[model samples]
Target: MKPWSFLHISDLQPGSPRSYRFNQAMGENADTAYKQLGEVEDVDLLLVGGDLTRDGAIHDFECEEARDRLGSLPYPFYAIPGNMDTCNKHTSVAGATGRDDPRLNVTAEQLDHFALFFGEFPWSFVHKEVRFSGFYGAVAGSGLPHEERMWRWLEDELPPAGETKHHVMVMHYSLFIDSVYEPTWGLQDKEEYGRWYFSIDQPHRSRMFDAFKRSGVDIVLSGHIHCRKPPETVDGVRFYRCAGIAMPQAANLWPDGDTRLGFYRFDVTEEGISETFIPLEKESTAEGKYGPGGHPHPEDRDYSLAWEEPPEEFRT
Candidate 1:
């Protein structure tokens, strides 16, 4: 077969200035990546890792904007929902952030809202000889219907469609922080909050890994950390902790983490699939913003500060 290429990008949370708070840099970075991605001549469709919007959980228009922009690309693409698109990972108790973590838990409605635009996830299909699959594993313990459906798909459904020269899996959350067998991270612990926030919790974590191994998923592409790490190969599968398009993060979390902003270009041929990191052509230096960041409480949002008048619906 002739060699072909595809691109993988995630965490492009280009927020709307219409929203209460906007990170100018994040919005610009996402725009730069999107434009750059379009310029790349690809042989196959793009694989969108997730977090396509800043507040898609509450703003359907943002979801629509994302869908329209991505849809305009010359090639087709598949995507899963990020925590920002749906809601945070399921949390039983408030974390060290002092925000209402319990209230921020992912909901069925939010998941369905994302699917309404992006399509139902836990979806997999064969393209040429390779199999591309995407799932939101954060749903694993949410006790929502999506959680059960995702598990069912991962266990019974995924293994059956076994067309493989290579199986590339896209997941929104890292399966683990440091190692596949790492223990469950505690949300209540201040120092552990970052890990807890970025990773899929246990039993679910182990089960997901089991599914990965059982289905012969050799390359697992994960986002949500916003920082790329040196590829980790375990139990024969290689985990690519992809970089964030929205911003850099976790500068001190991992000694080897690469905090550059970029997307991955993968080349597939007889030798097998090879990955390359294509740094964004331009990193937006645009500045200025209104309102707070990081899951701010509703009362904290002052829509009047928006550069543009937000829609009446979002003004609540």
Candidate 2:
């Protein structure tokens, strides 16, 4: 069976000096990973999940810097916008007041800038027998209009009734699993602030998941939880959350000490798909700790190397 490999990373919010430093380190890591991948053989593409910025600030230089770093790779790369990347008002409010606010609006300028930079790709695409789609922002009703339009596109674009193979959907937010369902880690509790971001209600989220299942999407990639954990399977759709490339934060709305900073790699073949988590090297971790002690740390840091084999269903 022919094989293909691609890099998957998320939450590369390069805003503050700390964010910049983190991204620099992540860029270095990506280079190392890519080199190692090259040694192994060929890598077909790089898929970056979202939250590419800190606050979606128009003046944020990190965005450009990130583009430069990511662009250095030899492989063709594609990306989507996360809540932070979307320029929604919540980011500004949270930044200015240091408090959660849900009354924010996604600015026209931010959307325009993102579209210009990203070239207005569809919410989804197909490459090498793999179908890829992504949804932006949180899953709440706050961005309903935009979310609706995206869904409409997805519904229209879904391969006709019974198409199958390796179908993968990538999004900034997790539709199934702890990130969206578990009360403690789910976005429901954060409804007030979530409204400013994005998150659909229970019925809508369920409906979305059903749509993916019906569409025969085998795997879903997401990031925003910041915790490096195994992929969770629900209703036959496997959801994998890529760890943030920058500073770590609370995992799934959990208290501060449960996040891990890292990235992921997906290997695809005619047979199936497999994913592995490539964590920051020891030197990088130490730098993350000593260089900036301010960032939150995970409890009982389980940085040990672990790989979650794709469930039986995903093994084509």
Candidate 3:
């Protein structure tokens, strides 16, 4: 069979100045990634892992802009929603500090709004003998109606969907921090909060892992961590903790983590699939930005500090 190539990129969150928050560096970084993607050659397809916009859930204009930017890519790209594009995972208990967790819980309305620009997800399709599947894994334990549909799709629809040479799965959150059996991280534990934020919780993780096996998934590409972890193999599946396009994080958390801004290029040959890390030719160092970091509460947002006049649409 002839060889083919594909690209996987995520977390571009190039925020809008019109929004309550703005980050100039992240905007430049995502623009750089976008330019770089056009230069990549012989790519059969592009897999956009997620975090396509900074405040896409709240700002409809951001989502619309992202659709145009990504649509301009040289090759066809399939995408899944990242937490930033919709909402964070469900949690009734508030975190130890900062924003309340329940407020961050993803709602059906949020997901539906995202689909208005990016199309419906938990999508699976075959191209060139490869099964490319993408989903918002953060929805797993949310208890939302969308979560029910996600479960039904993963459990009932995909596994039976015909065979393929390789199944490449794309998700926004890593299924686990390290091992498949690692305990879920708690929101109250300062030491474990990062872990908790980056991974899917228990029962759900194991359940999803099982579904992957049943569906013949061989490679799992996840991007929430923003740190590039060396590929790990569990059971028969290869898990790739992909690097971020917008910014880097959790560099010191893992000894081998590569905290570089870039994307992954995978070549599919008759033998199998191989991955190459394409680091951004330049990482943005621009400063002088305005915005509250982390998950800030709605009440805490300060539009007065915006560098540009708030767009009429964003005005309360």
Write one digit per residue (lDDT tens) for candidate 2, span 95-179.
2233334434455456556656664634667777677766654433445455566666666667753565877877776664445
User: How well does candidate 2 score on lDDT at residue 68?
Assistant: 63
Q: Work out the TM-score per prediction.
A: 0.97, 0.71, 0.97
TM match of model 1 to true structure: 0.97
lDDT of 3 by residue, 99-160 (tens): 57888899899999988899998899899889999999888888888899999989999955
**CA lDDT of each candidate?**
0.89, 0.57, 0.89
* Model 2 C-alpha lDDT versus the unseen true structure: 0.57
List, residue by residue over 1-316, the lDDT tens digit for candidate 1: 8899998999999998999999899999988987987787654899998999999988888999999999988899899999889888888899986878888888999999999999989899889888899999888788999989999999999864255868999999999989889998888999999999999988898998898888889899999999999888999899999999988999887999998999999999899888899888888788777789998777888888888878888775
Clashing pairs in 1: none
Model 3: lDDT to the true structure: 0.89
- Model 2 misplaced stretches (Cα beyond 4 Å): 16-41, 88-100, 137-140, 143-145, 176-200, 251-258, 282-316
Per-model root-mean-square deviation over C-alphas: 1.3, 11.3, 1.4
Which 10 consecutive positions of candidate 1 have the poorest summed lDDT?
158-167
